[model samples]
Target: MTDAAAPTPSNVVFVGAVATASVLLSAALACATPFAALAALSVIALPRPQALLAVGTAWLLNQIVGFGLLGYPADVVTLGWGLAIGGAALLAVPAADMAGRQAPVARTLAGLLGAFAAYEAALALAALALPGSAGAYAPAVVVRLFLINLATLAAALALRALAETLVHRHARAA
Candidate 1:
């Protein structure tokens, strides 16, 4: 049997849109792609398996855009950092899912914060093992990253809401 349940059409669309957006974001922001925001949104809006798929798609697309389009160094250290980011993104999914379950009223915000914390923590741990990585963890850098994630999450939510409203209006018209 397959490990994941069949994805709904909306889930497929969500994953595709998020992954595409992530690739574009990575092209612009490189290492500062808002993975925590994507992960949190996925977990908050989808089932566990679909959430994993969404986050994984975003991470994979970011890596492709980074290495293929953006010309990231094809070195061991760079590859290690990519893997670390993927791992952190994956970790954020579960953290956000758990927080969303616990706080229904503020599920989205709680999930976003939880996912960001987990993602940063995982990256910090990875930095300890990778030379020259600790500099990225400086307070100023972390704050900037957090702001990026927060803004991305807010924008994603707004876009999703707008999309839903448009779809509903179209359905009514039809």
Candidate 2:
């Protein structure tokens, strides 16, 4: 959160708003990998417990939609993928805080790269640790993820700006 956003009470209003925002944004921009953005949004808008709640819920919902409704295959890699996305989102807090202290573009880029890297690293570790992986990190998969990361982060940044603007506007109106 911002420097001025001291830890507020865990009231329902803001928490609900954050949850709704996360769900809507994640669904609307599913292709852009909104998990990272949701995590950063949590750090920016909510406190620690609430951040976890927001990101955790968003991640769960994403999984439900991705595998349940979208017909994604169930497999070991899919399980690992869930953990990776959640990890990326949860790990985005520090990056978001660091980026919050910088200019807008820097902030977004830092959040994007930093959070995605965390995901990539975690996934790599999972692959290394998993029984069937055999240490084979596919080059094509990496390339695809790199592209997804770039696009997702850009969309996330745009979403961040829109959310920040809305927050400011609401504050001003009050």
Candidate 3:
């Protein structure tokens, strides 16, 4: 048999555990901030299942933190945010996957930017769905999300690059 050379299951578990902790901690932080969970940003670079896992757990933890521990009102605005952020995860993940396959830097950047746009669109749709929450989208809120998403996209891309570099280095060393 060709000797197995890839990471073992235990390695996967270790990585997964670390990633989960990171996501959950980020989600906890998100509960206090104007930004969505940074977990949502990381999902852009992950595969679909992992993306779902990361974002879903983060969302759940965020709700627990915001509603359970902090006593944030479970109002339509809050609910709209949760749903909209989930929708944004769904909308942006595909763009991140596409970015992996895209060759040109321009195409990759476009894909990431498209993810940001998709997130905004999804958030808008969610707000519109809530009867009174649409008015909450004041200019300041819009600008803040726009800026946050910009930073999120940049961080996600940087993390992806770092992962790739590490993988490449490992391969070369092997």
Measured by lDDT, the strongest candidate is 1
Query: lDDT score of model 3?
Result: 0.56
Candidate 1 lDDT over residue span 1-174, tens digit each: 263567778878888888888988898899999988898888877787888888998999999998999898999999999999999999999988877346654888888888999999999899889866757878999999999998998888889889999999999999
Candidates in order, TM-scores: namely: 0.93, 0.60, 0.58
lDDT on C-alpha atoms for all candidate structures: 0.87, 0.62, 0.56
Task: Give the Å error, residue 158, model 2.
Answer: 3.9
Question: Where's the lowest-lDDT run of ten residues in candidate 1?
Answer: 97-106
Model 3 poorest ten-residue lDDT run: 31-40
Whose TM-score is higher: candidate 1's or candidate 2's? 1
For residues 1-174, write the lDDT of model 2, one tens digit per residue: 574445565434555655675556556655345555555556555666666776677777777767766666789877776776677666665655556667656765676666656656665676665554543357775666566556655565576579779989999999
For every model in order, what is the number of clashing pairs? Answer: 0, 0, 0
Model 3 C-alpha lDDT per residue in residues 10-35, reported as the tens digit of each score: 43443364355445444545532322
Ranking by lDDT: 1, 2, 3
Clashes by residue pair, model 3: none
What's model 1's overall lDDT? Answer: 0.87
